[model samples]
Target chain A: MLQTLPTEAALADAPPKPILQLVGVRKTFGSFAAVENIDLDVREGEFLTIVGPSGSGKTTLLRMLAGMDTPSEGNITLHGELINDVPPNKRPTCLVFQSLALFPHKSVGENIAFPLKVKGVDAAARKARALELMRIVRLPESYHDKNVMKCSGGERQRVALARALAYDPEVLFFDEPLSAIDYKLKKTLEKELKDLHRETGKTFIYITHSLEEAMVMSDRIGVMRAGRLVQVGTPEEIYGAPVDRFVCEFVGEVNTIRVKRGPDGLWSGVDVPGSFKVAPPQDGAALDEAFVVVRPEFMRFLGPGESADNRLEGTVYNEYSLGSRIQYQVRVEAKGGEKVMLVELSRARALPPGADPHVTLGWDAADAFTLES
Target chain B: MAITHKRRDAAIWGWTLFVLVVVYLPIACGALASFNKSRYFGFPVKQYSTDWWGKTVDSIEIGMIVKTSISVALLVTVFSVVIATFGALAFARYDWKGRRLYQKLILLPIFFPQPVLGLAMLLGFNAVGIQTSWMTAVFAHMVWIVPVVTLVIAIQVYGFDPSLEEAAFDLGCSRLQVLREVTLPLLWPGIWSGMLFAFLLSWSNFPLSLYTTGADSTIPEWLYAKMVAGYTPMVPALGTMATLGAAALLLAGGLVGMLVRRRATA
Candidate 1:
């Protein structure tokens, strides 16, 4: 299991100096800002994934990092050397485009050997390095002579990876490289990429819209919204302790109950027909109005003689099987009309057949986090 | 229903065949006449002889005209392709102020009436005190052909995946290296076709060449002079040679393209 650490604490207990740092980076296209005031430190030999919905400026930030686009404001440093004006070709980093961008006219071997050729490597050494990289990417050596256009999409992706690796760059940037692949292949490649990262020990900065993909492969994940990096933490921290409602909802299935603090120093749901115990707000800030965020897996049906800090009565409206787990959407009546709460449990803990409609859902206050609405 | 469908197919084939015959019958007639021994272009050949074909090769005036036309056409092809390539790259890769206006201006010569363009170029060269020579004819040919070559190359550039070039740069290639190793290789088809078009267009050009050619005669101008003077078997023989030369050039280009593609994939 991955350890969850608050972003601040993690930075404070630094293991090593960051290999890349962006201080107050901003990119603007004309009058509109694409990315605004992004400051980040990317640790050496770590897999950092930046994830966001489309148009969230994640790609723009990545373009700046890859040196394809320059930041409009502030500076980016590689190992404390300013690289804001470095062109992509001059930088010690490479980007694997989402399109794979394999040279359709060239053989796989030639495509992979292109960077080596640029460095003036001799023909024999280039061929040897190309074959080695092909093996590292798990592509068969026999396929090297095949035209890249003749290869399948997954095979082409492997070829692109091999080509990028041939540069032997200090850092590698992947711009949604597997987004075009089929689901099964994507899953396989995701694991392979994680393994490749470990084996190479290079700083990898990847950008994707898939939180699941980021969660599976990243040592640290940065979640962007609009034009801001709203949260950056380990996968456990991001999933368990998102900083805002946007981060909370973006990362996974979540249920938020709107609540307000009363003069009695207790919290009560504004619409729900009950007073609710809740965790303190993040950073120990007292809040007059707050939201209680609860993941479906943390909320369960209360059996007889069972209790929790926060409890509610609701009826299951729908159930969905998610392979090993089952999710139930329970409808609770409140003054606002109706509220739906999602409850998830292991398949083995599913409700018995023909159970009564009425059921009590409960969760410990510690499992439910509070954030200022 | 089957009968009507068959009738429709027959109609299409008939129209296609008619078009082909209309386009090719004149060339076929010229080729056949080139082999006829009769000096007069008659329906029936009085005799079959290789004299006219041999005479066409042996004639000093015809030889000079052919040499001048080939060199001028080659120059026009090279100049037009180079200029068009840069123009097409700019059009494909960048967005700048007045881009649409620039595109229209570049393509203006292609649509201009040939006689008017020829007259205007002749007058402009005279005004600039430039002597009318083979170079002037080459320059006039380029005025029309460059726009066409640029249009063809621009179309190809538009279909290109730009990320391929980006990936090259990311892989540590300099700008020149990316162009040499990636862009030029991928754009070979467009360049080849553009060169062929420029060469053929300049080779057969008549109106512009007539005004700007001055004392130097190109193949088409010489053919016109010969026709105006009198009908001869050598005229058809020269025509046949030009046609065969164009076919051979096209075949050679295709062979080279095939070989390059094979090597690329290998």
Candidate 2:
């Protein structure tokens, strides 16, 4: 009785509550479904990023979470309260758009103080709080009296951030806030945003089209494709164990080859011929059609006597220097007539130009993931 | 390069000024004729005097006409601008059934000749047991001015970014609050311009005021009746008075506009 009662008592110790949750949320416009069956939980003091291309429903999902839009058929709950029918103004969340919509006619102080003003705070207190927020956002106090339209693009961005933070919501959503900034500034802002998230200890839900930005900032990354969340994991998990070919290609560069399963329960793919093999058959495959996903860095140019579980002999059709690595497109005949195999090598060990086109490519059997068509 | 551009600009300015003078010569001549002391309209004056100005002041009918015109213009300007501001906001924000139809209907009164509109409005009001009075004159003037105000303000509303209102909503403000805080502030310029236009159209209206005004005599009607009956050298003096009144309005409008521009820039 003591052992059983003690386990139940031990389990009573709990973590903090999730700040935001979306349960089976979907949004449809006319006949087109924009966001479908999205279930997400944002924990306290976490920076979660949703990455996808255009029309991928990432922004639509963020909009629902922000209460700017209502989900068609599911519940969006914040702090354990259902918020499906709540309008944006009633929700304790703020969203920053790509345009950084600051009121051009208002001064920087007024722009940052808008939320407080709406709450009927006295003018002097509002200005003081706005100045405090400006300091936190690292904008000069002198800029407060200046018109928002007169500020540079970066300063406007800071004003917008200050305005959103003025609401002091438990959760904040960003809609591609850095997409319009220059490269150098974007890099700096990315680091600053990461530090800010840590400093504020508020949950941040951000949507962006750039994977690099997501990797730079997110504690957890969700990859979306065609209105569905495809993969969710840490940056390293997404890069190394992508759920599908689409997720693999979306996160970074990858090489894919068509394959088929032989009756011997072995996997045979094109471009590498019978010399290469794959373990385990893909589910729901017709015994004859398959594809294997391989990242470029996994494929190596073999030296004499050095060997791998899979190997291919091919002529190097083209080669390019990529920073400290050399990548080559090797044309070879394997299970079928011809295919292209991407081989990458460290620049320190690169063979001279003439040594390519007369080379062997090899990889471990487990390096390639096989998917059935 | 700036100097060359300025010289070309000055040459264009000179030609445009010349053309404007040519076009305005007839009005200028009429104003000049008002100063003549002849009982009959003549080019050269027998002797310039204040006789006509005194004559106009002595006529109680002309004085009443001036008062009626001012009241009617003021009423029409206030009402038309208010209604058109609402109409423009509706058309700008909501896309629904009959939007295009409503817009077309606003312009219909403008398309008809003023006399036709005046006659139709007179008959319509009479049928409705609405007696023609100064109020009816205001209504008729409003019919011509509302479209002008609506169209101008609608153009400004259409150009306005919808995000400003949305941003206000995001900041925990109601729809009406958004209008008060965001829409109206950005729309001040367009609304002011529309109001000015409506005021000008109502102030200068003649034919519509003619039919709808029964016992109340607007300035144009009073002037028309006086012109038909007899030759008073004071008639041209009244014309000069009217011109000066119009110039005063234009100058006030200009000053208000400049003040608004300077405040906005500051």
Candidate 3:
């Protein structure tokens, strides 16, 4: 079943077996279910990110995986050994908190060396390890004697990561550690975190609401919605080929054209005046009605003598510059009502400033995939 | 507008100074009169002497009362701080049935009339055949001081971030280690202030000590007895010592709190 996945085929060889497995795990708080019947396998040394909106149970699942909270049912195993009953301190895993939770009363070195101190490591050795970890996290040596509270938000985040690493756990869990940081710093930390993961070779299980962060760092992304793991795959698989409308919309901006099958077994756009060519369903199921999902970047303005599998006439009402790319909102009159289609193009390929407002937008059939709505 | 705002600030400062003098003048006068040569506590003393201070040290009865007060206060402070800190930790960290009711009940003694509470405790001790000694006074003092300590510590506990404990545990520390290394260190200011309050309250309490101390009279009860018999500069000397002692404790507590806060922020 896994052989059909593009990610699996692209791998150098058969990927390593999972180091941790969660089978039918469920957690309930009284009558309310925080996480329900979640099954996942975490490959050794792989960076996996679970992305979801708030209250979607991503944190609940991470808590159970980190051993801070026990599952109400099912089993969790590490290296094929059942560990559902283990407490966080007894387990070989550490969780970096959303708030970082660095000790304000202690210096940065002392905070990082706390785990070592608990293991009864001597003073000299602890200091050496702490300094080494500070370097690994790109923190200055002078910060070792400074109090954790004096450090800026991003610096505190690095201190927290260094502390979590000091535990030398088999797996490290992160609970939106970058949510409190500014955008510019978050971007830097995101790349640094991916580099750190590669350097450490430890399994990283991170949870966040930012799919962009997941796309940037995760080897595989798990999309969660309402206490359930809706889909789990590589970033390319999640973004280019989402399983449903929810996954497609959650990942990035998408344009969906509703299409219905005609008596001749050809799919026709239900709203627009003409039929639209769409790629066959990836699942190979014959569908009477489906949504043709096309990303904004895939849809472009057709030039003179240019052709595509599907084309529609629309008036370009507004255009927005998003750094290197320009997004155009084209209003098209359909049989049902007026519809707006988003088209994005690079700055170099953007329409001329004085171009006619009435334009033809088109996308190749191969660039758009069909999914049952 | 700026000139009027400056004038308003000056007026506020003047009123504050006036209120401070009004509130503290009597205590300052009493402290000063302790060094006067005259037996009566009259203003505009003719001469000053250390005779009353010397008398306090020389008197055996007064010495024993001071010893009793010190011992009782120490015992009450230790017991109250330990019990209250544990209670506050439980209240801060967990939710259980009747938690609010238990919290209210623990703090109930703070609002009770001290004389009535002392009387009820004395009666209860008599029914139980327990003799009223310095230990009895310590127990009575605990009843009043424990709630205050708990309330003070609980505010700090409430402000504390529980995630620090979780982080500690995640870093391979046991529950006991987390409490010892993280929770208690962060709560040092609250514990220090609570201990000071407990000791001060127990040492200075008069009404509660009146009924609880039978054979072993505390300093406050002894001083009250002396006041009833006659007026003396020695009484003022004792008051001066007590006031100085309390002021020293407050100063020490403040200094420690400031130092802790500075270290935390540094």
Candidate 4:
């Protein structure tokens, strides 16, 4: 085993070369920069998502990559060739817009086969390929002749997907196409999109503000704030290890206890009892002052004789039933003031109704991570 | 409360009918005069005959006037629709500096009195040593009609999704291809309505054509001249034909509009 280590290490070291690369790209309108300098490598055949709130430059970045807008600074390369100034029509890329943008005047087949038709393909071949794409997208064969406007919202989404695939682009860009979809259908489409990415082996760059949506489909997630990229990681890394308070709170419900190291070499919390046990910060920053970030599900309710690294008592102000699990909103009275924290539990382990409002919430030092302010 | 609603509804319908009759009374009178046996129009016809209608239909002079009116209307419609389609897109779709000022300036012509506008144009043409004819009348009509048609098309342009054109461009269509394939088809309904307005306004116009068409006369101009020259039974017969022609064109335009909408959404 020791003799084979070099060969195995060589095999494990192989990484996919990027199909598209951006370096120090910035876009501005007049004096206002819509997207700041950015560096990213989109691996070949991977699903990458950019997630941020409105005006966070997610759309601006997607537009630049899609060839709809040019970067004011730096270079965008496709397959090691500069394509920074190529217009969208000449670029081997396609964008599925936020509105889906189906041609209201065309039938489903015409809409799907538009790019093929633009290539001057014969009518029969265009129709044949459109039908094949429709099958790939799982749209019914009968919908080929139906007007696009007559289709339901979910059907329209399938048509848009088929149209984008018809172009046979090297990379596909999606600008929040599922944002307008209803909840139940959005969930189904998210899974179907992930499966489609696997089947096609084509690069997909998707943008949305919903982190949950990004987590379901992306191989890598890039979190954007203001006009800059805050962090880039896999879904597990983004959820487990955020960079700062913005990204930490953005992930979801969490219990944050701000703490400062004392002269005696012990960490003391400012929000609660000032005795929090925290792991070192992930970024390797000085940990003199930091926040202990623990997800709600990692929190435990300490009963009589139960033990944990740190414990805090708080009043249960509200309880929410989240299907198989439940969450409690607790208000902890601390040295500074009262701070709200969320604790979750499975249904079988739920706290009983009419119980005492005050309870102890506990967690191990290993279950929580620390972040520098 | 039910009785009050019934009474109010009756009053509304009564007012509507009264207004309709008052508006259409001149056309009805003209129709009656066309069939009257007497040479001059008189209330309560003693007899009815098709003699005036036969004479008006066979007259070459009247035919020339009708042809002239149609040619001017067609020319005006074509020019106005082309100009207004671009105008509407710029007004409501594209974002540019001073767009608000451009919109306000484009609509200013619609507020001017038509006769005064006509007189000013006639004087300008005369000062330039340009002779007036039916061709000049077409231009005169277009000056007013293009702005009105632009306003009509802008309402539809305001609702158009700009992303549709962008999507087409992204899907491998060139700029001109995107315009021909997506932009024109989406704006077709508005263009059709603008065509109807341009044609009808040019067809029935009197003041502008009166000043501009000096050597070449249209139906309205000819009718006014004949009425001032002397009364003839053919005048009312010709007026009745003009009214019927306009009504038929309007009905045909409405049917075409309905069919186009159905096919688009079908």
Residue runs of model 2 more than 4 Å from their true location after superposition: A1-16, A263-265, A275-289, A300-309, A315-330, A334-359, A362-367, B1-18, B44-46, B50-60, B231-244
Residue pairs whose backbone atoms clash in candidate 4? A268-A274, A269-A274
Q: Quote the lDDT for B222 in model 3.
A: 78
Alpha-carbon error at A280 in model 2, in Å?
9.0
- What does candidate 1 score on TM? 0.95
lDDT: worst 10-residue window of model 2 chain B: B26-35
**Model 3 DockQ, alpha carbons vs. true complex:** 0.81
Lowest summed lDDT across 10 adjacent residues in model 1 chain A is found at: A1-10
Q: lDDT per residue, candidate 3, B30-88, as tens digits?
A: 77888899898766888999999999879897888888999999999999999989989
- Candidate 4 is scored at a TM of 0.96
- lDDT rank, highest first? 3, 1, 4, 2
Pairs in clash, predicted candidate 3: none
Please tell me the TM-score of chain A for candidate 3: 0.96
Candidate with top lDDT is: 3
lDDT of 1 by residue, B100-213 (tens): 898999999999999899999999999999999988999999999999999999988998899889889888888999999889878888999899999999999999999998
Per-prediction DockQ scores? 0.72, 0.57, 0.81, 0.87
Clashing pairs in 1: none
Better candidate number, 3 or 4, judged by DockQ: 4
As for candidate 2, its clashing pairs are A273-A335, A316-A357
True contacts kept of 1: 0.91
- In angstroms and one decimal each, the interface RMSD of every candidate reads 1.5, 1.2, 1.1, 0.7
Query: Model 3, A207-320: lDDT tens per residue?
Result: 999999998898899999989999999998899889888899999999887888876666678877677676654622488888878899999888899999989999999999
